[model samples]
Target: MKNLSSNVTERTERRKGEEEQENTEERERLENNRFEDQDETTERARCEWDFHLRTVVSSATAASDALGVIEFGPSGELLATGGIARKIRIYRFSSLVAAASDADGGGGDVALLDHASAYDYYICTPAKLSSLRWRPGAGGRIIGSGDYDGVVTEYDLERRTPVFERDEHGGRRVWSVDYSHWEGCSVMAASGSDDGTMQMWDPRCDGGECVATVRPSATKTSSVCCVEFNPFGGPLVAVGCADRKAYGYDVRKLSDPVLILDGHQKTVTYVRFLDDRTMVSSGTDGCLKLWNIDDARAVRTYKGHVNNRSFVGLSVWRKGGLLGCGSENNQVFVYDKRWGEPIWVRGFEPTGESGCERGFVSSVCWRQVGEEDECTLVAGGSDGALQVFVGTRKPS
Candidate 1:
């Protein structure tokens, strides 16, 4: 019977797919990375925070999500940027101050900060970078970067040389990378890739080899969009997945996830710990949620910033309950977790003014306060522009 044979064949194909998904989960589960804890943390709240846009700068004209990367030195004295191009640029904070004084394009007291004359160097990667992070140490002279080619390279600015490199993702592009240091542990780095694995690397090891691998997804076919280590001093990591699930895993035991949070309507683009007990996650579905990790449940959901499978960054405000993220509509959005909607979202037309490049805002970070005299917020996106924001909080 031809009809009977066709039905049986269809059933066999469906079963095969299910089996493959299960095997993928099994293989990826036994892997792990040193990205700061991405898991929901359990900690006390800090003081209230206030933030506002301040400066903007750019080197190229065209838009590139790859170029929308920006990072501050550990001490906040220097800033580094590069992604779409093969070269990375470093600038001194004071140099930006000097630019603020320039008459022609110097943007008044605090308009656009341009210190492009500071430093520039080429990276050996064949493709553009996807992520960049500065190593934490006394001088913060070393930086780690992941590229579209699935390679991870560490550069030593003090030595002006490539310190180490490796590719453990089967030639898949790396999406995110981060470094971490425990009180009595060797420094380690974590990189998430399109290959559906997040691998950990030890710098002191020969050739900076991968120490462990983890699969924080329900199925092996899902890609890891973001990975972070818990700064609360644990073996746990929070991972965002293309499958629309965010998982919590302990490196010590990758065979099983400690917790799984699923509710996003699309790919989970970013996941970061708000504190030791709470985590913030964003999805292409256009919803940002804060989860109380203790119970593995959603505490609140904030909306406004749009994401269509983009790696948007999220950071907690120091004072009380503020959260910030970049938007697909070329804006920087900040919300109070206490509210259901964003407090405000701001951007300008791409008129080529100092910080007015109205391209999709993609990457964002909150500058550490002790290192920065003021509460500082920074973001980068499609237009290859770095926009900076300063907080205006009156003293308590």
Candidate 2:
């Protein structure tokens, strides 16, 4: 009788454990389904956006054609463009809109060709410009640029002259330059170069020498193609390199990278911080990877743009959680952060002209938005064409 009672108790306990396990499995399945539903809703919203071309501007001279980069000022009041023409063109955002409005309801196919009246002023650089960045909290008075001459220069837009210049890459071509506000006040800058190193600079350091330098890896002979400081305010900095990987490091500790994102089959051309804990990296392997630093792996991969080689630009609109990049097919692609597919694709030519076999969209940027219903996108073509697009969501 005692043996029978013990057996009965054991059976009861096992049955209860089995029931709890079944319940847990059911909960997991339901939670996964719930997430799938939410993703579907977000994707539907992304598909409902409509973007239209607002303005078109092209190089004025044949000698200085082929734009490489385009950037908007911190306040979105000014636009700066640079390229193989070795000239930095500055245009007032209001002026571009006024010109567009005067054309045809601000949505004409009219192309402004080297129109002197369209641009406020232009600066001639020593070499082809590769990248442009506007200084943070400077009221659009200062802008920095990287050039093929292997120099990083900061220009005072108010005076139209370079206020600071650094030539430490040994003429190996400075591919990217970015600024960071450290300790809430100290302004620091960084540049990535073909020299396979990213150097940090602080103007207050007295002699203009870079304060620190970080390499991608000790064994890899890869060039540092792009560098980005965390826009959300932190010591975290990331660099994309020719070794087909992106490395994330803390500015306070440069001895080793805290995270390594390694899925690209080709060179990683660009890196942009999506938030404090996540980032997006673009590779010539024809895909964009969304990485979670804590996990030390890519959370998602975004593909649709035709990028196999060349530095097609990558820009993120944090407010909208949208990623914008140029395609080798002379088109612009926009992707929602939650989806792998592109939400929109538009050709650089507004009139649907088909002579783009030799040209591609080399640079793209989304205007930073705040409390606005509409957003602006600017893209640059290899042939020195600039197109501005305005995107808005359709009323549901």
Candidate 3:
């Protein structure tokens, strides 16, 4: 009877050992699988340089002239493009349909299968249009246009006529016109001209008189290539000049510049504020400069893109933390907005010289989609069409 009991105990012990080994092996297998899943997820969220060509719109203008500027509507429902052809074209969002409408009018549920679609209409300008800006809260219907004849016209698109016209530059070409977009931003439009002056005009005035003007020092009387109000909600405005210099002026004090930032070797084409204290300027010198408003000099410079003929403005998409610009060769180069490091480059090349002549990319803007890890970049081309690129943002 004792021997039988000992055999039963031995059997029980062997069975318990086998069960423990099985449990350990199962746990090990689960841990290995968990690690594999973690790695796969990390790989999926990583940022990839997979910018896809969305659509191509050729001969966007009837005149076949160079398209120099493109701006997104305040609500992203429309696009406004203008250029040397003296025409302002408006395009409605193509994805908004009965089948695509969301509760918030966002059309988020729609699938954009044919991404390069836009229905276009145009309005003629009196002179070669140099710049076009949409008024705030006009739903992209009201446009303020500046021309080479130093004329500034505010037009109501729905009305199909000019609200007012101003010749503040006085026989000089109005190189740039931009809205302040602040508390009373649209109340007055800022115009920079080849007449070596920057003037503010109130379109509502009966005569379209210049209410204010920014006068730089005796040397800065050179043609003002571009002028933009400080977007950080202030009275400061930065104006780029043909003499390879940029000056920041307080709107309250037009007699002198608050500070001057000079670093480019050639003409300064565009200047804009990334923040109240930080700004970026691009020039024909094939470089982009970052300047601190507190200092009189630029902190850093980015290069490798050329700009000789037309102004290729620097665009900063703060949400995506990106900075990029176009070249005369039609190439678009992107960089890290924070550190100014090159990321990727792309350009459109058709058959030959006929396309190349109009292929120059003069300006670019980045538009971010709603709450999505994606953005659409549009470049104004000399070919009369806008080059569109869609990019996906990778998880950091």
Which structure among the candidates has the greatest TM-score? Answer: 2
Q: Model 2, 1-396: lDDT tens per residue?
A: 999999999999999999999999999999999999988877574665788887887644554377788888887888899988878899888878777677775345543545366778998788899999988878888889999989888888878888888888889889999988557434888899998999988855543567788887664468999998888888888999998889987888888898889999999999998878889999998999999888877899998999998888999988878899999988899998988889999987732243456678999988885545677888888877888888887787
In order, candidate lDDTs are 0.72, 0.84, 0.72
Clashing pairs in 2: 60-114
Encode model 3's per-residue lDDT on 1-396: one tens digit a residue.
Answer: 999999999999999999999999999999999999878855543434457555445552244567667777777767777787777777654442322333224433322322124435677887888887777656777888888888888888888788878876777888888877667444766888888888877666776667787755356568888888876678888899887889888776677888888788887888877777788889888888888898766777887676876787567776676677888877887765544445778876542336665567777877644445776777766666556677776655
Candidate 3: residue 23 lDDT (0-100): 94
Worst 10 residues of 3 by lDDT: 107-116
Misplaced by over 4 Å in model 1 are: 1-52, 60-66, 101-110, 113-115, 118-125, 184-186, 318-321, 351-358, 371-373, 394-396
> Tens digit of lDDT per residue, candidate 1, span 165-265?
88778889888888765543438778899999888888777667767888876588898988877766666678888988998877666677888998899
Worst 10 residues of 2 by lDDT: 106-115
What ranges in model 2 sit over 4 Å off? 1-46, 60-64, 106-115, 205-207, 350-355
Candidates ranked by lDDT: 2, 3, 1
Query: Residue 391 in candidate 3 has what lDDT?
Result: 79
**TM per candidate:** 0.78, 0.87, 0.78
Error of 3 at 78 (Å): 1.1
